[model samples]
Target: MEQPPVTPRSALHTRPKSQGCFLVGKSLKPVVAPIYKKNGIFYAEIFLNWSHIVGERYSRLCRPVRITGDKPNATLYVGASRAVAAEMFYSVPTLLERIHHYFGFQILESMRFVNDFSSPHMASTFSPKKEEAAPQNSEEADASWKGDDITYPPLREALMRFQSYMRKIK
Candidate 1:
């Protein structure tokens, strides 16, 4: 009788467990935004530029930014120059009143003015690029619209909303 050869166990059959790998050091608190928006308005919990200055000047100053809303929250982020920020800080309350008169709701809760030195990335990201001029006629616009169906929901909604608003005012 010939002796049978023994087979070795395959290393591919064994694998490491990864069940709790994602849960490590997880926090329960909602991370407050450096900025946020609700109901077509924008809010910021912290002014990073201001915070940096305060942190530099005083060792013991501590403050958490607060935002309040009752319903239908929407948040937006806009990057502006230091001059615009200063204007916003000084004029936002009066501006809000005018906005409410026109829109029938308060859109912005509060704003924080930040110095231009703080966030260069924001200004760069939103800066518009020079592009070929868009077609002027409806046919061109329709053709552009029909070329891609999957990615146009937001654009379509905005156009529809504008159209509706225009019709309502007319």
Candidate 2:
């Protein structure tokens, strides 16, 4: 697949560059966006998924961390409780073992946990509806199906052809 050319940041905007920092319009504050390299390497700024954390006692004690990397390299950083940390001083190896098994080797390197001040907010509660509503019509149902384009006839013909081919092989 052909990719669109990436416009250099310098060409798109006028800003002073110094020590890997860039300025945005009128604000002295630096603007930073996570830029992933083509080789599936990237950084992730993550906070705990508090809803999931708070619900489970074990997970809450040893807070689970989240990390996002560029495509094919996203990872989650899991932390341990003080006691757990003390017991296993060399924690990275164990954590890496779990991560490698769960997410595969390409996505993760290591885990880092610190006494960060922030915690993510939990979602509010909502009542489950007693009776779910049915779709009004076929048009509404078809509209709800996600995709850029829909060609049912061609898809149906393809499926029929595949089934015929399978039967012949059997």
Candidate 3:
């Protein structure tokens, strides 16, 4: 038996100056467009921005399932329950208008309610969330204080109150 000379792994595989694969100056859009068309999710922005498009009320209860057809005649299918579908029936026009307004053009011609589609928050009705107002005390004054980190909760509260008072006097 005879053994051949061994070469370093790095030396065996040399890096090429120009690496070309498949082709250059070619686009993959043609390949991906068919997949998107077949999946019925061509307009991903509609689904991703459903919350902004439909507003808080419907955004929680409804979701964009798929968009069918081409521009000027495209249909948007939304997932909702039977009750939600009925509740949303009258507001379809309003929602469609909002969707169109969101995109700045009429990408969707109509919206169809899909009862077959289901989601976890279908039956939930949520009240508009209230934002808590910031404290009246000056934030700059608090930031201006060069105090060590206080481990005690009560001491921190008292220190915050003292800072508030000092800021008021100044």
C-alpha TM-scores of all predictions: 0.24, 0.28, 0.50
What residue pairs clash in candidate 1, if any at all? 37-74, 37-75, 37-76, 38-73, 38-74, 38-75, 39-73, 39-74
Q: lDDT scores for all predictions? A: 0.45, 0.47, 0.76
Between prediction 1 and prediction 2, the one with superior TM-score is 2
| lDDT per residue as tens, model 1, 53-162 | 23432212222233345322422233445555554556545544543454456554544443443344345556779998898985565446542454688886787677
User: What TM-score does candidate 1 reach?
Assistant: 0.24
Ranking by lDDT: 3, 2, 1
Ranked by TM-score, top first: 3, 2, 1
Residue 116 C-alpha lDDT in model 2: 27
87: Cα error in model 3, Å: 0.7
Candidate 2, residue 60: how far the Cα is off, in Å:
6.4
Q: What is the lDDT, from 0 to 100, of the residue 53 in candidate 1?
A: 28
Q: At residue 93, what lDDT does model 2 achieve? A: 67
lDDT of 3 at 75: 92
Q: What local lDDT does model 1 show for residue 117?
A: 30
